[model samples]
Target chain A: MKERKSEGNEVKVRWYGYIVLVIAILFFSGVFTAFEGPLKALDFTNLAGDFGKLGTLEEGAGSLASNFRGTGGAGAKDAWMFAMTLFPTVMFALGVVKVVEYLDGLKAAQKLLTPLLRPLMGLPGISGLTLIASLQSADAGASMLNTLAEEGEITEKEKNIFAAFQFSGGGTLTNYLSSCAALFAFMTVPILVPLAVVIAFKIVGANLMRIYLNKVCKQ
Target chain B: MDKKVTPKKTVVDAFVEGARNGFGISANSMAPNVMFAFVLIQILNLTGLSDILGVIFQPVMGIFGLPGVAATVLIASFLSMGGGVGVAASLYSSGLINGTHISIMIPAIMLMGALLQYMGRILGTANVDNKYYPQLFAICFINAILSMFVMRLIVSL
Candidate 1:
């Protein structure tokens, strides 16, 4: 009876610890913090801020209206671009996944990937497809994981681990080319060097999550 | 001797079904996510909340050897990479930031960009439990910071 009581106390302490951690993260990331000054209130003098000029909160309403209309200014253009680029790819990739399923290609791929993934990331072979897709598109990779889980191809634990991997540096290749590459074009440092560094560390982070999930949330 | 064979779907049928399933997944999972995130990010972008965030995070950004003003670019990224790219390009053109600074910033930006949208759209569609979102963000942010340090060290070397 005493031992049971102590164990219960330990769980409570751990639970409280988690809550504290979450709260700290929120605070440090500026959930409670706000800047003081004109900058604090978004600048509306500029064209970007013109949208803000329509009315104090009107820009927000406009944004919502634009979303429904599937249109907007620059920001909406970008979002549309994202959808245009990714939606087709996702659509095509899903077809490919379908064909692969019929051909039993996933199993063959899994067999090939098992040695590498299981040993390094503690994930199943099927997760290899998701990883590869993640290089090009994180959404595709994540969606695939969802599909796999729903289909009973991977357990919940494996899904979580794979999700960790995707989250660490999702859209590895695409993002590098699109964002980092441009940012580095004029930089003195070689582009590949930083790119490689981010990838390596992202993998490290994914591994960290894998370890934690496996040990702590193994259920 | 007698042989038995199971009927199989024709290639065309398989392809059609695959396309259907693909579209279904995209529509059901990714479309709404994209729409919702687009709306939220649009609001944030137009309002310049991201700029406010930039000012607030200047000190922390300085730790990465980036100019405090670079927080603007970082904040813009949270809404969309294109905006982030635009901010970065302008900064680069104006000679506010250089290659070395960019090296550190790029990795960090990639980690934290598109926060609400990426979380709601990608991970949300995957049904990643909400409980893990904070943990995941924390892990990714830490990883970016670590990468920034490494990149900074390498560039300085």
Candidate 2:
């Protein structure tokens, strides 16, 4: 009897330890203190017109006006900058995806991801490539899934599930590493914490979407 | 596995085909979508229409700790990430928003950005029926809102 009681206590302690570990991970990932203190300290009303050595806010406004006035404005410049920064990455990622598809690399990826993703994502193994492509461009991922659906490798239901997954935060890596990452470069806080937190929530959102699709869109 | 000998294309052929497919999709679909959002937001900013929209959305955005002016950024983001980035950069450089705001807002923005094009180009190109577009969009939007709350919680902690 005493041995059994001790064994039960040990199991309880183990469970407590696991719970503590989970909380620790959450804390370290910045899930607990994400935007609170910083937001309270922000001055959102005044346009900081001259930040990071950029021209005054008035000049910026003028540039924005010029952009619309058909005189090369800040608006036009930013638009050009956006395209220059983003489209190349999109093109590169899409090209890589096409090559992977053409070479039948997806089959290998599917085989590897099936056992791992089946239980976690409720998706077929082949949809793994789609997930990875989504990290680059959601469009690429969606197109890949469509191709799979056309080949009859995945059903309409699975397509919806995969779409939900990709749709939640598509182009995650690309956006983070390029555009969003640039935004964070000058911040006081560490980038990893927010990155980890966002990724974790995206997974949650994706799985929630999977459950929703399963219940409502039964095929 | 019946590994049938598939006709192999040369390296140059594979590369060329992939490049064409990539460039074509971006130029045909993605580029137009991003450009549309970019131009529209610029027009709105220039015309001061964004301020009116910002006033309308202030209360809603305030609930999430965002400034009223964020309405314009959010609208632009809802159309494309490139637009979102452009707006965010302008706002940031102008001192309208700071790093903390950007950090908190980034996740939700990433999740919610590019709705119209994502639905029309990505899913449509996949040949999904038009009927499901609304439902899919709702799912993504809800997910983004939920992530916003999560981001808020993270920042607040």
Candidate 3:
């Protein structure tokens, strides 16, 4: 009975799923970043919000503004404070990801990605969901791919190529927004810039593996 | 056809579950890793090893438009992404590298992030042939270096 519902989920495509999926993409895409007021709510970084500054102790002549972590701190105590500041952002991003997944936003994307997966990554369309799953959880994706390999659904070359994508930047979505929040403040580019780079390289890395397998492996 | 009914999970519930996971991850993984990075940076600074590193890695890192000290972030990132970011943030705080350098280092950090850990988590679990592991590792390092070039171009623009 549980299997039936799970199958239905994979087959069913709700009309609202596409809409919410697009909204979710825009939310993470930084497209609405420049908008004002409530519109800014659509952007990830804006909704993640900023901390209150300590403000100037002196007049305009000598500005004294600093974050709650302050300045000139070193070692573990300083790292502790810095990490503390990051918790809220990570929490918000994960919470939103969960909310989107609950709404079937990611499944909607998986559906769309299924066809493109082949031409894009040299993967079969059936591996689309697993590839999407890899972005959220490395263990889950790896185990699922192993299942595919065990069942003889994917060829050895295909498994290796997919493994290449998963190896570098594994669990990308979770790790990037959550684990790498420390570098967010220092980044001069939009949040998506680095993410786009990582994703592009994941594909490139997989194709490079593909080239190696085709040319050298002789399998 | 008997269909078993399952209760729908509300959006709030989903968010709560994920947020709870975030708390656990931050406490267990991120916080300790960053603290470890901070201590590593301190040791490098106090031992005056950072300067020596700056001198040694200068030529290699300069190719990526990064300072020699920026090499530490990439090195730490190879072990754990959180540590790499911590090293980058620490360097930024010390005024060794600015926001532009951070932007350039961003993609490279995660492209090669947590490779040693994921070697088992990703490759071992997936059960890829052991013979290809060397090539797989090489591909990731190549991807990381290549991405830095792309990020450097974006930063310049």
Chain A superposition TM-score per model:
0.46, 0.48, 0.91
Estimate the overall C-alpha local distance difference test score of candidate 2.
Answer: 0.59
Which candidate number has the best lDDT? 3
lDDT of 3 by residue, A1-219 (tens): 335423212646667878888898788878898997788889988888888887666555765536888778999999999999989988888898898888888888888878777888899877877888899999999998998889887899999999999998999989997887778777888887899899999999999999999999774
Best by DockQ: 3
Q: Each candidate's DockQ score against the native complex?
A: 0.21, 0.21, 0.81
Clashes of 3: 0
State how far residue B24 of model 1 sits from its true place (Å): 22
Question: Which CAPRI quality tier does the interface of model 1 achieve?
Answer: incorrect
Query: Candidate 3's fnat?
Result: 0.82
User: What lDDT is reached at residue B76 by model 2?
Assistant: 72
Highest TM-score, which number? 3
Superior candidate under lDDT, 1 versus 3: 3
Cα-based TM-score, every candidate: 0.55, 0.60, 0.95
Residues A1-219, model 1: lDDT tens digits = 123321111212222344433432232223232456543332111101111122234444544332222332344354444444334444443454444445544334334445687778777665666765665577897788898889887777777767766776577655554444345345555444555666677567778887888688756
